[model samples]
Target: MAKDDSDIYAALLQAIERGEFQPGSRLIETELAERFKVSRTPVREVLNRMESQGIASRDGKGGLIVAELSQDQLGELYDIREVLEGFAARLAARHAAPAEIELLKEMIASGKLVEGEARELAIANKQFHQQLHNCTHNQYLQQMLSSVQRSLALLSGTTLAEPARVVVSEKEHRMLVEAIENRDEDKAEQVARNHVKNAYKTRLKIELGW
Candidate 1:
């Protein structure tokens, strides 16, 4: 990938992740090229790569659109997340450095300051999970978790959007950290799994407009 192409790719990915290019929204190469002030060739390449990564898909009309997950697909995605996150927490309990533990604690503390701010807390939540993935000390696990996180960006809105969910999620994060701090791998894994489960429930409710 040339520098320009890399830049274009990253920008497009960010746009998708930020929900600017919403799921099922068409990605017209010519329009994207004009929007990014680049040639259609690079836009086409970026779209191709995104399609291969499951970030974009064919619309059955010979055009590309942002990937959309059906309800069943969403449930399957969360199932994978539950297992991967639990394993990451278990590994963190076994392998996280003292500094990493302190960093997670600091992150949780900062998260408290954004209690009522759903968007901020949502971003913080992602960072916290990424830290946990880093603490796992397994590159393969981290890579898989990273891919899951990217796929999650296809879902619009955050579970933390509700103030009640935000409060509950904060407590869940604290519990996981405490379990890890105590070096209780089983407890950490269970807590992390529960957290993902709660998130899945909330997401399902949101999807159902409840």
Candidate 2:
């Protein structure tokens, strides 16, 4: 699309990810246009793009609203993530370059420094996973993982926001990276799968207020 349209689309998507426009909240084209200082045409285009990605949908009132995942849907998404990420970790154990491994180590170190900063820690966590996906060196796997990561944005609050969870998560990251470094594909896959499972448990605690 045109540059302006693409910018508007990205901005709108970021807004949704940041929970500015909450789940199931109606999205009026005119309101978005005014808020973004853009015209209705670009706003409409962005909304259409988001809808196609399952990020938003038409509400009962015929207006578009941010998409909300039911409990079952969230569970299914995590199941797929566990499988895909486990595979990625296996591949990374076999394929990652020395530099890539070094980068992963650096990411873990940086994550430790940012443990007290929720937003920074969240961004670091995302970067670490993204780098791990790239280390797999498979374009198709990377694309699927990227899509799953985007869907995760629909969920409000970072799992790392909990201080106790941050400690556990960092330890998991270290374990996964160590497995990759040792070229232990099975261990790497298992660690990655368990990491996702732990994340899901943490998500449940937050979602259910446990």
* Tens digits of lDDT, candidate 2, 1-210: 234888887777777777798889998999988888878998898889888888888898888999899999899999999999999999999999999999999988765525657767877788899999999999999999988987887898888888878888888889999999999999999999999999999998888888
- C-alpha TM-score for every candidate: 0.93, 0.93
lDDT of 1 by residue, 1-210 (tens): 334778998888878877899999999988899888988998898989889989899998978999999999999999999999999999999999999999999998874525646667777888888898999999999999988987998988888887778878888889999999999999999999999999999999999999
List of clashing residue pairs for candidate 1: none
Q: lDDT of candidate 1 vs native? A: 0.89
lDDT (0 to 1) per candidate: 0.89, 0.88
CA displacement after TM-score superposition, residue 87 of candidate 1 (Å): 0.4
Per model, state how many residue pairs clash: 0, 0
Candidate with maximal lDDT: 1
